[model samples]
Target: AQTVTQSQPEMSVQEAETVTLSCTYDTSENNYYLFWYKQPPSRQMILVIRQEAYKQQNATENRFSVNFQKAAKSFSLKISDSQLGDTAMYFCSEAGYRNSGNTPLVFGKGTRLSVIA
Candidate 1:
């Protein structure tokens, strides 16, 4: 069994500043994908970034990026120039083995971030 942990219950970042959210997971599998999903007040889950276990380079998308530490089993999200729209509940997730589409993604409790001016 695999588990994701997000120690921060909540965080606040000023607009245009940078913020990093921490995440750690326990997994023995060699091949898998890690991700950060953001859920706003609308209750929709949006994929923020993803990192492959086999890839050494950290994943990045515009202002969003991830620090993937394979040996430490840590995957953290860094958001640059935070904006009001970045305010949301961020969840760390891992893809479990099972390509049948029946397997579920293991997620953390989530970190609620508030971007203020």
Candidate 2:
């Protein structure tokens, strides 16, 4: 079984500033994928970044980056130069293989991020 946890329920950052959202997971599988997704007010799930359990390097996408600590089972997202568009609900998820097929992603409750001007 795999589970994702986001300790912060809500967070706010000033515009053009930086913010980091924390996530931790517990999975028995040796190989899995960790992800950070952003859902705006329009309710679209957007992939922020993804990290593979086997990869030693962290994943980055534009202004978004992840600090992946495999041993600690921690994956945190850092949003740089935060903008109004960054305000959304962020979810941490994990996916593992099952019987040669990818299992459905298990997601955290989500953290609401507000980029205040």
Candidate 3:
């Protein structure tokens, strides 16, 4: 079984500050993928960043990046230069079980991030 866990239920940051959201997962497969998704109030799923197991470099996009520790089974999201628009529910998910993509993403409960201006 592959399980992704985000221990923090909620987090906050002042405008322009930086915040890191924690995530951990349990998986037996050596080659897999991980993703961080942002869901704003509008309820749309936005891809923040994705890390491929084979890549030694962590994935990054604009202000969002991930600290992927494969051996530790930990993947964390780091947000720099946080803005009001960054407020949203972030979910960490694993993709690459034999039936992973065929089924819906098994998501962590989520971490609601609020960026205060």
- Give per-candidate clash totals: 0, 0, 0
Question: Sorted on TM-score, highest at the top, how do the candidates line up?
Answer: 2, 1, 3
| Candidate 3 deviation (Cα RMSD) | 2.0
Candidate 3 lDDT, 49-68, residue by residue in tens? 98888899999999899999
Would you give me the overall lDDT of model 3? 0.89
Candidate 1 regions exceeding 4 Å error are 98-102
Q: How far is 51's C-alpha from truth in model 2 (Å)?
A: 0.6
Error of 2 at 105 (Å): 0.1
* Candidate 2: residue pairs that collide: none
Task: Please give, for residues 1-117, the per-residue lDDT of candidate 1 as tens digits.
Answer: 889999999999999999999999997565789999999999999999988889999999999999999889999999999999999999999985555553478999999999998
lDDT string, candidate 2, 34-92, tens digits: 99999999998998888988999999999999999988999999999999999999999
Worst 10 residues of 3 by lDDT: 97-106
Compared with the true structure, all predictions reach lDDT values of: 0.93, 0.94, 0.89
Model number with the top TM-score: 2
Badly placed stretches (over 4 Å) of model 3 are 97-104
Q: Which ten residues in a row have the lowest lDDT in candidate 2?
A: 95-104
- Cα RMSD to the true fold for all candidates: 1.4, 1.0, 2.0
Could you estimate the TM-score for every candidate? 0.94, 0.96, 0.92
